[model samples]
Target: MSIQLRPTRPADIPFVYETEHAAENRPFLLPWTEERHRQALAHPDIRHLIVEETETGRAVGYVIIAGLTNPHGSIELMRITISAKGKGYGRQVLRQVKRWAFEEQQAHRLWLDVKEANQRALNLYLSEGFVIEGKLRECLKTGERYESLLILSMLSSEYRD
Candidate 1:
């Protein structure tokens, strides 16, 4: 199945919200409000994109690049969600977004913090060239317990190849 990543349109706001609100995704993303999304569309440094299935024309996920700044170039994945986890959309979207960040944004580095238990996502990031730079113990509370956070990063020079 073909897939594409395009600049998110205003009409995509609701679908983005729904996809992020799905059961399997809720815990992985920060909670957002309608006003937040509206503001996001206007945010200068944030690049938000929507993922669409080409054959069925369905909205499946979104990728958000936030915390952009010059010189000290850095980016954090504000959000990423896929309707289904193991269907390969996550990797496709991640690679595309990383390429855009490396080429268009000229980012010096891209970084993300994943819950220690999110092995699936950690594996994807590692396979895509992000290295485990550090770990923070009990950094975030997932439920009744605390979860360690793993900091993963990939440099622009590394991605250039």
Candidate 2:
């Protein structure tokens, strides 16, 4: 099946909330509240894109690009979920999002932080052209223990799309 990404609409909230609230997604969230999601969905600098399954037109994934103004623009990928992980869809969605950010948003650089233990995500980011910039030691408290954070980035010129 093919996938198409487009600007997210208010009507897409339920899908967004459902995908984000899944138990399996708890580890990746940034302790976001409902109000945060509301505000982010409406924010101008925050580019929110929804990946739609072409045949059904249902949102299968979403990505939020935040902090878009500076020349060294850093976009925190607020969230990205594909119902099922380990599939190739996540990579495709990320590439499409990066293309949109570079070609449409005119971003100079893109950056994101991943937990050190999230090897899958780290691998995805690296394979997608993001290089490790630094590691923030014990930056996030997942539960009772704090986890190290890996900072990754890519320049506009480095992006193929």
The best candidate by TM-score is 1
Q: In model 1, which regions exceed 4 Å deviation?
A: none
- Can you write out model 1's per-residue Cα lDDT over 1-161, one digit (the tens) per residue? 66788888888888888887888887766668867887888798887888888788788888887877545888787667788667899998888878877898888889988888878888899999999999999877767988788898999989977
**TM-scores of the models, in the order given:** 0.89, 0.87
True lDDT of residue 34, candidate 2 = 58
Best by lDDT: 1
C-alpha local distance difference test of each model: 0.82, 0.77
- Runs in model 2 deviating more than 4 A are 71-75
Looking at model 1, residue 34 earns an lDDT score of 65
